[model samples]
Target chain A: MRATLMPVRIADDLYEFSVKDPPEARALAKALGDHPLALEVVAGLDRVAVQFAAKDETEVSRWLNQVAAPEVTHEDAADPIEIHVKYGGDTGPDFEAVCAALSLTRAELIELHTSLVHRVEMIGFTPGFAYISGLPDDIEIPRLDQPRTRVPAGSIGLSAAYTGIYALAGPGGWPLIGRTDAKLFDAARDPAFLLTPGATLRFHER
Target chain B: MLHILTPGLQTSLQGTPRTGYRAFGIPYAGPADEVSMALANRLVGNAPTATCLEITYGGFEAELEATCTLAITGAVGEILLNGTPVHAHQTLHGRAGDKLTLSPPQFGARAYLAIASGFQAQSHFGSTSTYLPAQLGGHEGRALRTGDRLTALSTGQATATLSTPEDLIPVFSDAFALRTCESAETHLLAPRSRDQLFNTNFVAGRQATRMGIELTGPPLEISGDGLMKSAPVFPGTIQCPQSGIPIALSCDAQTTGGYPRIASIARCDRHQLGQIRPGNSVLLLRRTPDEAVREGLEKQTLLKKWLGSALP
Candidate 1:
């Protein structure tokens, strides 16, 4: 555990706290995440970026040291939310290329991918785009060398072990293994983003 | 409300940034040049957070439906009211049915047009700023297009004229310098790469946008292992990808990134950042974090003194 508190003042209103430990950092993240004064809790790998309003830094700093960090369950050990996907067609143009790169048949690929559940590490890039952790080692791959100018929304993409869905299609480089019809973000929905950090996710072939 | 005759470059409605929701991957969309936007809003008796049109590289035309007090700020563009020359940095009285056009394309990028009492818009996640990627807020969640009409909160009764204080006016230049503090991972860079960041007069590339600005010069070669674990990144962070090209994250940048950040531009210079055009060359002047913060506070105090109070 990081005994002392050392926060890097990134900007006039932005401060980043490094806890070194992921869970403890997440604990601090969750503890003050939606706190009225903190404003936004932007969590990084092992740090929580507290962006406060101008002139509120002193008060926010005081709120930081005394706050209790609640225990947050790891996504890997949490209950899984099933995601239905369509592999290897218009929805997933890079499916064959991915399988060929990994030396796995379509069935083998599907079996390996669906077997171990993934965890939502963080939400980033675009609105509602969650970075999923824990892909099977055998199926791990890098992002495409040439990014597609326009990727379809709902595209399931992978770069290294991290898999995520492009909630709203735009420019993307992650190799698409498949696509899901599941809505990750919708303005009309009560909570716009369907996936939150530390949530478990499972893939089911449709 | 004003009717858009032509959207010109990329005109969108932006106000104060949508802060606090970055954890959900929401980009903090707002006016690129915040200081200029605030000044424009204040000139017309509206709060700086009021909704305003963000015009890019000039080429915009609009006709007013009602008379309103308006001020245009940021970038240098020729403003014409019904084919007559009008100047920026001063409040202009717009009569109903009058036409306002920003033309001739300024050397700088982005301009803010704020009307008195502000334009009314729905706030999504606590901001009216337009972020098109998610189609979230602002006028239909996208750039203001041709034939689109926007109504002011209240208008047709002109307010008293106000001109910017002579010393408070911004100076536009094609070349400038930004003071920056080296990042935590600065030691990871090759000594030459570190030197290039501060010494090189890097030119802003054509790929500049509200999301980020690409600076092209000598490729800032790095000898690090490879890609890094994704980490939190701020608007003024200057990150270098595998390509060695440095990218300055702006208002609409993602909350986090995987590339190695070389230096963070001082918060004081970000308002200047919005005015830097594609061809503009900039030097990343080095500064300590404490120095950066102190300079910013000083500037803020000066601005408040000139504006007669705290900035909106």
Candidate 2:
């Protein structure tokens, strides 16, 4: 059975749709990714908000029906791309504290972080900052009480069930587990962001 | 090159926000007062989306490198041509050494100065608007400074004059009434919070900048708690954080936020937001969804009819 669609009013031009979970949300994103009225699509943990150029209830309902279709599958079609990460060193300042809080050793934390392939849940917070799912629930942590004045670019940060890489250097509170040499965001690049929503990726210790 | 004699508090080249990129966490970062920017471009016979200088709170001056014609719109301030006062709402000419100076904004919070050929500022992602947070676009991706020299993308007619209809100009005042409409979480707010949001008065906070306008007033009460799953937010989204102060997002707002979106300034009345100065009292008046769209369409028709040759 399919999950129930929960539509939330975000703003005059925005309507947010939440389904069962991250995977079900991805299915909804796949079904309605190309609607002309969907000027912008922002995928969240369990929801996807579409900013319509013009608010049309009928179009929204039709789009929701398409998302609710039984044939939709959650997996992204692209082959997983692997990212190189240097974990628990100068690159990650909060790594030891995070490991201790989760009662994990350094090696255990790295193994847990890289054990499974992750999917892009959303790209928000900052330009090119991708929220990736698949961090071990056993070691899931909260964002720092006080955000650092600056979190260097390519730093891997974890909060709750998701982990993300800082695309641009700015203020962020996500607990750093590692850093990557990979360029997360490059304006000169054809695809500016390393991971767009629905792209599957895997992180490995460098 | 147009010599920057003095840069205003915040001066930057403006183009429309980068659309379709919001999903990537990029805010549109366009001109805050699009209507005024359009009028300035129209008067100079430039494309509506052509690059122009958006001067915040005036205090800007520039030297004409070559004889040039330009148009100014938005703020009502002292316009000096070679130290001589020149009137606004009409095009003005300057010789190579002629200096144009604009005093502090007397009526509006921002002003537009569109040169004949539009600015040839550096661009990223096909937009010239400066987004300060990311240090992207404009001259080295920051606000204009005194030593900064700008070049026009192209040269146009040396001399021309045009005036916008007086009826179209939005009057800037200490009191602003923004027609607002409900958002998704508006229903989640406490009944008293809803009443306070619409009926209460708020003074624009000192934290007001291009990104958003912070309002100081009674904190809006809400029973719901916890950060929202980050979602797409527009320029007009009114986010009331736990602090109770409401921040009305503007052209430079972030792509998504976790704050409760209690209301949104209607699309039609958003231009007025650019003219609202900090400390200005704003009233969040209620508006129907139908009325919001109708007014926006009406304004679009008005712009098309008046600037037929200039509009896209």
Candidate 3:
């Protein structure tokens, strides 16, 4: 069945598509990413905005009318990238506090975090900062009362429903549980960002 | 080479915006007011997208190490060349060792300084414009400070002296009536509150930054859940936080936001958001999407008359 794309005009050249859930939004975003006229596509949690290269309403309308909604595949075809993490030490100052808040021991916290495969819902806030979805509900917690002045790059942080990676050092409020040596972002690299929307990843405890 | 005697308030190099990277959480960091920047560049014979100096709230002073053709445009009070007053929005000739200074602005908040061949800076993610938060692009990826030295990209002589026509020069007023269109969550607002958003004159709060501007006025209550899933937001997006204060996102705003997007300033009126200062009055006039697009096209046609393809 073709998914309906009822795009609402956001600006002269920008249009937004609101979907029922993240999976649908991701599928729509992936389809729009390949559209010839799309200059850019930003996928939020439940909506996707496509910025056109130019204001060509006729072409846009025709395509929208004719195009079929591509298949919605929650599981990515490629293997999940593994991120090695060092949990619960100086690298993760909030580790003890987070464990206590969630009523779990260090090993249990690490196991719960690494057990599930998380999909990158979006990359935002800062360059290469990936918002990963699929965090277990039982261990979800609020962010720090006061944000840290600087979060080390490669820091693994968790919020209520999402886990994120700190691409570069700056102010952050997410409760950190571990640190990784893998580079999250390098502007000089061809693919400046280590993660992109819809990519699946799994955390591995060292 | 140009020597910064006093860097004023947050002076930096700006040029064409970095595009095609917003999907990776990058912002389009370009000149706040593209019209003024283009005018300044026209006076010095530089391309509209050439790198130039963006000075905020005036009080900038600089010393020249070489003779060059230059132009200053935007809000201003007094322009002094070796203590002799000069005018803005016109081409100027400077000699080696000459000192140029600008006083506080009389109305607007930013000024554009363009040299004959433009300034040279390191490009990051595609443009020379600076993104301060990520420490990317421009000179050292930071604001210009005292004692900084910058070199001109090229030393060619500028085109014949020219002045912006009086009628073409934009006037910065304390009050602005910006055209806007309803956004994703506009209907979520109470019917009375929706009317209030259009009828009331909101005052710009002091918490203004390059990323966004805060407006204070009568609280516009939202009948439904004000918070929604994070969604893509742009420079002109007006997000209403739970505090009831609406914030108009600017060029450096985040790629996405969680606040309810109440309205979006029309593209034609978005440039003015760069000049709005604390305490300024703003009225968000409602317009349909079709009307907003037509206005933007009309404005672009007007801008193309003198600025060529330059559209703010």
Candidate 4:
């Protein structure tokens, strides 16, 4: 896999390097051991955001130069976990709205949503929240002009070419179109989060 | 032995935030002002991340169930122990059953009340810091209320007189300088707007919350009209929505936003903005990532030095 590193400064001592994709990011993360800087691999469909702490600008530039083209081991991608969802209606108030905008029926929407295989881009916003990419073009929908004051936890929504499931209930503006009952986040759990960057997911209509 | 006579406004138990929970959208909410909180904690011989009362705009009055060493930091407010004048930011030894009353703040917002051994609260996600939105962490996941009796841990050490005076307490002001770096959307704005952001002074809007602080100033115009894709956001990100006004994301801010971010405040200076109340004037200055990191490290080093010197 070809990898390109782009050095971006977050702060005086905090710097981030955007690797072109996951294979390169995984490789670089392994090569750097016990570096004082905190390493974060921001998951994306085709790219990853590699962030680290820097002592200074000079150190950041030097580290970027030294770590370019680091060796990495490639492993077989994990099997996509199938998540069940109840789409469109009271549980998914925005479901019909989304279908109407796309001029598709409820069944058609469900088929399109379920057919595409998605990769976990990044988990953020709240605990266990997953940003899954790889949606079909016809289903892409824009976010609501006015965000909902309260979106129930586990409410799945599609907005602006991306889809994600909420881990916790909070004020969200995303156009939610479905709900999932699976417990994606539990502090009491050993793993804490069920989804991580690079995890693949497939949706099944419950 | 603080007895809650009235919880007035919002009060909660907080400490250093839980780590490794960022992936779950949980922020390390600990104290808004780490320096002040640390100083208060040190004054009473409590752990640096020990639970303490984070009182906002004070009017909280509690009867002291027992004598203990206490220190108040952040906003400048009238503090009275047993209806007598008490200094802030210095250790005070109160008699058992003394009633401590804190009047509304005259300047600044949020105050830290630290006692020896710290206040005891249930730990959630490895922290006592309360994230109100999730209804998790802190004392029962809610703000302190009247008639709430908070238990304090035993220090087993005698209270010592504080050498620092009340007037010398560290007080953050409204006219604070905020450090910023070019954001991902920086290129999206007019080239001239880049220079204008620093030159323009933005006033804090009344709609400030833990999630974000809205700035009211010269409206910033974006060069591009097309909507940008959503991206991960952190505290200090300055996002410009269609409103033309810029909003600075804070601790309780959303992890991702679609608005064009003109700049991001450095991590260290984020706290300075966090502590500012409504109507506070903020001056934004552009700094290289290197400068921001150096300043942050320097601040951290100074805090460590202060902690070392204060501890017995």
Candidate 5:
């Protein structure tokens, strides 16, 4: 843990705490997230931002002063959410391109993809778009040279070290390998997002 | 009900920002110009958070189907009631069948229209503001189209005529010097590039929208490889990409970004960002965080004094 965590005021209603460690930053976000004044708590790669209705740094500062760095371990994870995917067809438009680029057969690619457990690193881009991390270094893929103006919702995309779901149909550049039926985001749902930061999951071929 | 005779470019409903959901990749989508929205609402005797129409580049026309009072604000040029010229920033009474038309703005890019009781809209995440990309909030989660009808939330009863004081009206111009403060990655910019950012005026590129405005100027050089972990970005955040041009995030911008954040427009000056038109000249004026806070509070105090409890 760092010697001290200081919150930097970025805007009138926004304050950012720069913590280099991702897990600690997420832990810090979890600690201060429930503050009454905190409208939103977002944990990013190396920082966490707390948003409030107005400028209230004194209360946030007091809350931060009292927070002890909490340990984050896999043992603390809840039951993994299972997502079944339909791989390699029209739903997976870039499957052939990925197979050609990685020099793997269709069956081999699916085996590599389904074997490992993925962790939700962060959520961004669009509502409920979870950036699932833990892609093996060897299988890391590049984003498309030209982004599609609209990638259908529930489309599963892989790029660099993360796998993402197109929770809502919009523009995207990721290479899609499969599609899922699960609704990642529905404003009508009680908890809109299916996956949140730090959640773990595994994919299975349908 | 208001009958849409002609929908201007990207006219849609906006209300108080959709807060408390940024972590889900949702943005605080609301009126781009919060000050203008408040002024318009006040003239119509509605609360500051009441829903209003956000018209981009003006060119709007509508017919009132019920007796109501209306107020227009923001970057506006010519306004006509029943084809006779009318003024902006003041309350105007309209009877059934009266026509209201707004010409393209003379300077800025957006205008706001508010009714006495506010417009009825589909609310999402506790806001009526439209988030176009997500197809959420506002009317049918889309921009207004010709022939579409908008209903008032309740029957409007006109209050005493009110006009915004001359001193309180905001000026829209082609050139703006926005007050800004350093962000998470400000130090990463090279010394020469950092100086150039604050000293030079940038021309707004063609890609201007509620999401962000692309700016073109001398390429700002970064000292390092410029790769950083993806991080949270808010409205008014200035991000520098590999191409060196900066993009200023606005109200409808995504919750997170991967580009290097060089600076952020001070809260006091961010409302003006909504008025920025394509090809407008913009300069980032640096200030300390303490100075930014003071300026923001002072502006809020002024608005509160004028609008009373209506200023949120």
Candidate 6:
């Protein structure tokens, strides 16, 4: 897919250029690494953020333009992880409200959520918390009016047009629909995080 | 060995970050004041990124369960070894059964304790730095409590003799200056506001943490419609939320945020931000990218020089 590069500044010395697509960003990252400046590639689904140190905004802008080249597709694509979840209970306090809002039974909602494969668009909020896209339109739910003081780790939640899994217990406003047993983040592991942007994920009812 | 007789405020282990995991939404959680932390490590001849205790607001009392060399840096606090005064930045040999007491800091907020061979703690994400929210890193993923004992990895070398006078130790003071550079959202603010930003003195608000340091100042009006889609944020980012008050991101800041950033504090002056306590007034000076890079490089060179001299 064709992608456009957008130059964005993160800090004084840190300038980032985001590619509209992942392939182009990865390609740019590979090419830019040969340059004297260090290049950090932060990949998202539709965009890839490349950060570098620069002397000025003009120099950073020039570098960003110079690095924008033809997209190179990755040979080894990201793998999809399948996760099982127990939906609707005290663990998922907002599950019933979500089902009622969607005019569907808990079973139907589970079927809808499980049927479609989701792509990880981004990861944010906390460690290993993947923001997955491509959820079924029927399962879309709004976030809570008041964010819970603390969201338990592995709590699967939905808000607006996105679905996410919380890796750490912290304050969040997303509507809880289920809980997953899969440990998304384990610092002891070699890679640390199992899910990366562009990786696919499928949810199943336990 | 260091035995915690009393753990005051909050204290945890910290070191250089475990990066390359930010894509997983994990922040590279490390020492808040990296420069100071490195200096402490250097004084004790430990690796620059070695794990150390990050004590906040002091009031911590520990007994030297075994003889060891240690150094403290960052905040200006009273340190006593066996009820006698001890220097904060210089390495000291604590004998077995010696009691170390740290009173509340008279200036600044946090202090770092570095051992000769560094503190031995469990590794998380390849580092001992604690990310408290995730309950990861440090000793069992939490702060040190009373009666907790910490073992120092065997340090064959003795304490370094201070070439510089004791008074030369970098101590905290109220008159610290923070440096800044224009951010992406600088254009979104009123044209005159850019000039006003450098002219205005802002106060550090109570709502501050490792995640972000919120500043209270004259409300800055901007022409932007609303918050943009969440984008990656780094330390030194000066983000203005709906409240219009600017907040500077710190070590534990989120990977991404939707707030409009006004300016980013320069890397050289970030330590000043870390040392600032609530209600402290700060003046923001505008800097160009070139100026920021030069300053950062200069700071790095100084750090390297100090490290080379301090280490065996």
What does DockQ give for each predicted structure?
0.53, 0.43, 0.44, 0.35, 0.49, 0.38
Per-residue alpha-carbon lDDT of candidate 1 for residues B156-254, written as tens digits (9 for 90 to 100):
556779888888888887887888988755666788988888899999987788877788998877785535556677788887776778889888877
Q: Residue A166 CA error for candidate 5 (Å)? A: 2.9
Query: Which model, 3 or 6, shows the larger TM-score?
Result: 3
Superior by lDDT: candidate 1 or candidate 4: 1
Angstrom error of the Cα, residue B260, model 6: value is 3.0
Q: Quote the lDDT for B247 in model 6.
A: 80
How many angstroms is the interface RMSD of candidate 1?
A: 2.5
Stretches of model 6 off by over 4 angstroms after superposition: A1-8, A21-36, A44-65, A70-115, A135-150, A156-160, A171-181, A189-191, A203-206, B163-176, B190-199, B218-225, B309-312
Top-scoring candidate (lDDT): 5
Candidate 4 chain A: 10-residue stretch with minimal lDDT: A40-49
Candidate 3 local lDDT, residue B256: 77
Q: After superposition, which runs of candidate 5 have C-alpha atoms over 4 Å from their true positions?
A: A1-4, A11-13, A20-23, A52-66, A71-110, A137-156, A171-182, A204-206, B310-312
User: Could you give candidate 5's per-residue lDDT for residues B211-254 as a string of tens digits?
Assistant: 77877888888766665667898888998876688889888877
What's model 1's TM-score?
A: 0.91
Off by more than 4 A, model 2:
A1-9, A23-27, A30-33, A54-117, A136-157, A171-182, A199-206, B156-159, B309-312
Model 2: per-residue Cα lDDT over B1-312, one tens digit each: 589989979999888677767767887887888888888888878777778899998899888888777888888689898889987767777678888899987666999988888887778877888887777788888899998888887664655578878876666778888889988667667888888888978999876777778878988765655345555667888877656677898887776665667788887777777888888899988976667766666777888776663222
From the highest lDDT down, the ranking of the candidates is 5, 3, 1, 2, 6, 4
Off by over 4 Å in 3: A1-4, A20-27, A34-36, A53-62, A73-111, A137-160, A166-183, A202-206, B310-312
Question: C-alpha displacement of B61 in model 6, angstroms?
Answer: 1.1
Each prediction's Cα lDDT score?
Answer: 0.79, 0.77, 0.82, 0.71, 0.83, 0.73
Pick out the ten consecutive residues of candidate 1 chain A with the lowest summed lDDT. A138-147
Give the better candidate number (1 or 2) by TM-score. 1
Ranking by TM-score: 1, 5, 3, 4, 2, 6
DockQ of 5: 0.49
Quote the positional error of residue B25 for candidate 3 in Å: 0.7
Ranking by DockQ: 1, 5, 3, 2, 6, 4
Clashing pairs in 6: A20-A46
